[model samples]
Target: MSKFTLRFNTIAAALALSGLFATNLAVAEDIRVISSGGFAQAYKNLASAYEKSSSDKLISGWGPSMGTTTNAIPVRMARGENIDVVIMVGDSLDTLMKEGKLVAGSKVVLANSLIACAVKTGNAKPDISTVEGLKQAFLQARTVAYSDSASGEYIKHQLMKKLGIAEQMQGKAAQIPATPVGEIIAHGEADFGCQQRSELLPVAGIDIVGLLPQEVQLSTPFSAAIVSGSKVQKNAQALLDFLSSEKNAGVIAETGLEPVAAKK
Candidate 1:
């Protein structure tokens, strides 16, 4: 071929390649995910990065993994809502697996979520370092709020019992559903609040006092699973991969989530 002809052919190939790249960028898939507040921030971190890398859009919803309330993920699944993936407290995800709402062999631990205590940004940070301190904070606060999740359930049932202030907390504590406890405190609706640390870290206008004392602490592992019959199974798995990557460890930690140890 002549030099001019060769140059023209190369230019044509370059244009074709550019067109393919543009098409890939424009062709996007929507991956719908439902997870509890505990894992929402970490999931958001993964979703925002995944969208850029995969050219897929993420549609995420927040709620408890299981509950009698309409906002629960289990309730949404029962209503036949389409979901590509679920990130929630582990035992609840196990219930989905048992009920066949999620595919078998798709469950993976993402992180261990621990509970946190918070007060409004301008308020004095209360010490919850001891069991007595935790009890004092609740007894002294005018209003206390907690997520109506497993962590919250523990606070309502076990923690209150341990503190021996179960009766005192009655009517004084509020259970915030489908929302973070830190947010309620931030809004000044509640003078004291506790929720999953990951959920609290992302909310503005709140100061995280600290993790609950070991004597009254409750931690649950947050996990991800592909929803059964999802059309975007492959894409959902891609999101899980991004969340589980070693590079995301720092991001996860910053949100008060303990990265899951790699399985042997």
Candidate 2:
């Protein structure tokens, strides 16, 4: 072949390769995610694994599944922050979908979180194995702390009332906002701390007593959904799939949550 033709073919090949690289770069998106504390630990572990195996990038943020705090996911959505995926309570996700904040049919259950109690690491563990025992534990504690999220709401509105100690707990029990209950207990700000087992596990200087008794247990479903206005819907869906996949069930379970993927 003529040298001119050979040089021209080489140039054409280089252009084609450059175009392919650009397409690949476009396909790998930076997906922004906001995860509630209930699923944060497990999501972090799974996200690390996903990042290692895929070219897509994840930008993570934390907030309560339901709250009016400045950092709350719903409040962030209301402020029109750019987000791609949300990992939060199932009911809260449903509320967002009803409000048209999340894409329809994009919700996926990741795990079930059970309410649990904790105390400072060196403090005596309370007996919460039975309904009455839990009540007594709460009534006896000088000060109690719970999250401002789903588990805290349950403790404040339903569980305490069901235990017939709502009146007694009125002054003693306080809802901790924008912070984990375990942290409160760890700091000795409260004698007893109550929140999702998964949320408690991540905090240091606290000993998780145990899950709430079956009679008064509240099992919250932690779910993930794509934000309605996300520019990277496909990448967001992939992340949700990775989080709820059977392959990640062990990691989810290790974080003190019941993996919904395993149940399926």
TM-scores of all models?
0.85, 0.91
What TM-score does model 1 achieve against the real structure?
Answer: 0.85
Q: Give stretches of model 2 more than 4 Å off.
A: 1-26
For model 1, the stretches where C-alpha displacement exceeds 4 angstroms are 1-28, 261-264
Estimate the Cα RMSD of every predicted model relative to the unseen true structure. 4.7, 2.8
Question: CA lDDT of 91 in candidate 2?
Answer: 95
lDDT of 2 by residue, 58-90 (tens): 999999988899989999999999999999999
- Steric clash pairs (candidate 2): none
